[model samples]
Target chain A: MIAALLESFAAAARGLPLTLAIWGAGVATGLALGFVIGAVRFFAPAALSWPLAAVVEAVRGVPFLVQCFLLYFGGPFIGIDLTPIVAGWVALSVYGAAYFSEVFRAGFMAVPPGHLEAARMLGIPRNQAVLRIMLPMMALAVLPSLANLAVILIKETAILSIITVPELTFRVQGVGSATFAFAETTLVLALVYWALVEATAVASRHAERRIARALAA
Target chain B: MSAPILSVRALERRVGDVEILRRIDLDVMPGEAIGVIGPSGSGKSSLLRCIAGLDEVSGGAVMVEGRQTRPGDGAVGMVFQQFNLWPHLTARENVALALKLVRRMPAADAAAKADAALARVGLGALGGRKPAALSGGQQQRVAIARTLAMEPRVLLFDEPTAALDPELTTEVLDVIRDLAAAGTTMLVVSHEMGFIARLSTRVVFLDHGVVVQAAPPAALFGAQAEPRVRSFLQTYLDRVAWARDA
Candidate 1:
């Protein structure tokens, strides 16, 4: 069992780069889309706002695994051929973007009306005010939520194993099946995920404290 | 006297189903310090918001230097009661943001101007600090410095010292008084009767979204007041007198 666990650990570690790449790509795409969606919801006309609202609401209400299955299995029916990695990126991006949209919305809303008024009074253009004053402040307000989303995205990368992506979780499953060492392989996978989340949480806490001190200053 | 720096003619504002301000007509002259005093629900802040172009006037118009005040026109400078300094920015950076973004000043020039504005407010040494690091009064001063850096012809303040302790309130009021001395045209909404008495050239008394009395502070505080004005003064004076003795 010990030897099997060591072999599984090495196999999983080999797939670490792929896991990080998926997380990076998915988060980047999700963040961009989320920002655009959140801004429209906050500032666009009701006609435009309603559609974006529907998209966020529908996506958020469904389970992420179901969304991933739909992207993977449902794509071929629509005449679109997507590899498992592509399907995982699509699913995670959609799922993360919906959650991030709400986070950005709350951050923008937390900004006081007085700040906008002060900017306008100083002759800052409306777009300039949003860029210089509103966006920076909102970014600070939403940092913690963004950090949480990142950690969740990292964990969710494991779900890609269902579609046969050669990620950490998939490697662990493969080694366990080959060696018939289910408990040992599963324990190693669990430890890997635990370390990843713990490191992320510690970094996030440190960044939040630094930002809070900067904001207070 | 020089032409009025700001003019509001029959201004009205409605928020939702309720009318917040009605038929507000006023002329603010250059270098004049005017105090707007009113009860809690009298729309004093809303009136100032209209003047600052923070809110649209439902009816009538506001003309600054003969040009209509439009969104992002950058005519007036405003200081809010909450001292809305950007928390992520240092005092100098907060003050410079308007200059850099609005006035399109060079970075070095904006920084120099921000430093000067901070110095003017007696915050030169603390320009590196952020709003959270500063006390309430210091935050308010940073807000003022941010406004003053814009070089606005007219300044509007909405309840500038409402959230400060007595000592901090005095510190902020001193900055306002100095602005008045520098001949900045100011339209201020404040509940500080003592500051109004000492600094205001004209005092506008508002009640229930209407201007009940527009007079010198002395007339509003003295025996010449209307019965309504007398009652308002009595309540205000009683509070101040008690606060002073205590």
Candidate 2:
């Protein structure tokens, strides 16, 4: 069983690069989209905010797996075609973005009005105030939730296996079936995911501490 | 001779149907210190905020240095009751940010001026500390330093020491006293009657968004003043005396 597990690990390791790529790209795209949409929700004029809120609400209301299926399998009807990996990227990013936007909005709302009011009274320009005063302060409050979203995205990458993306889960399933070592292969996959989530949590905790200290100073 | 450095003519502020301030007229000349005194919700801070252009006035214009100024115009600066220093910036950066943004001073020059401002507030040694690390009084002083670095034509302080402990209040008040002595134009809205009595060249007493009286403290505090003003003072003095005894 040990030797079989080692073989499964080696096979799964080949899938690590692609898995990380999807996760990284998805998180980056998601965070960027989330920030923009969240800002619209938080500070944009009412006319602009309502529509953006509708879009965010629609995306979040659907299940992640269904969204992935619609993007990957449902695209041909609309004459929009994407490769399995690209579809996986879009699906996870959109899903993650829906959650991230809410987190960012909450963070912005959490900021005391006094901070921005002071900035205005000091004659700081609006753009500079948002960048220097609002966003950084919001990040200090929202970062842990963002880190959690990254972990969720990392796991969500597994769903891409159904679309024939050769991610960790896909490769692990292949190894398990070929060798009939389902138990060992599954165990290794779980351990790998556990490690990833743990790393994310630990890193975010350290970031939180550093930010708290800086804010306290 | 010249127009008052900062002037508010017939200012009115309304939120929905509620009137926060009404037909308020105030003129602040160079080297003059005017204290605004009133009970809570008497439009004291509202008047200050309008003069600073922090809030929109439904009617009337605020003229800074004899011309209308808008928000972010850098003509006026205000210190808040809560010492609204930006938490992320250090003391030096907090002061320097205004200089850099409003005055368009070069970074090096801004930093030097920030240091000078901090020193003026007796916080030169703590310039590197963030507001959260400082005491409440120190934080308010940093806020004052930030406004000073802008070199605004008039500084409006909205209950500047309201959030401080009695001991801390003096530390912040001392900085204001220095500024007042140096002939800085100021409009202060405060509940600290003693400070108002000591520092104001003229004091305006407000009630229900109306100026009850605008006079020197001696004129307003004595039995010779209007009955309402005298009554308010008597009540305020009694509260202060009770607080002291407690």
- Which portions of model 1 show Cα errors greater than 4 Å? A204-216, B240-246
Interface RMSD, candidates in the order listed:
2.1, 1.8
- After superposition, which runs of candidate 2 have C-alpha atoms over 4 Å from their true positions? A1-4, A179-181, A207-216, B240-246
Clashes of 2: 1
Q: Score the docking of each candidate (DockQ).
A: 0.67, 0.67
By DockQ thresholds, what CAPRI class is model 2?
A: medium
The docking quality of candidate 1, as DockQ, is: 0.67
- Pairs of residues at least 3 apart in sequence or in different chains that clash in candidate 1: A123-B74, A216-B132, A216-B133, A217-B130
After superposing all C-alphas onto the true structure, candidate 2 shows an RMSD in angstroms of 2.1
lDDT of 1 by residue, A122-168 (tens): 77788988887888888788988998998888999999998888899
lDDT score, candidate 2: 0.88
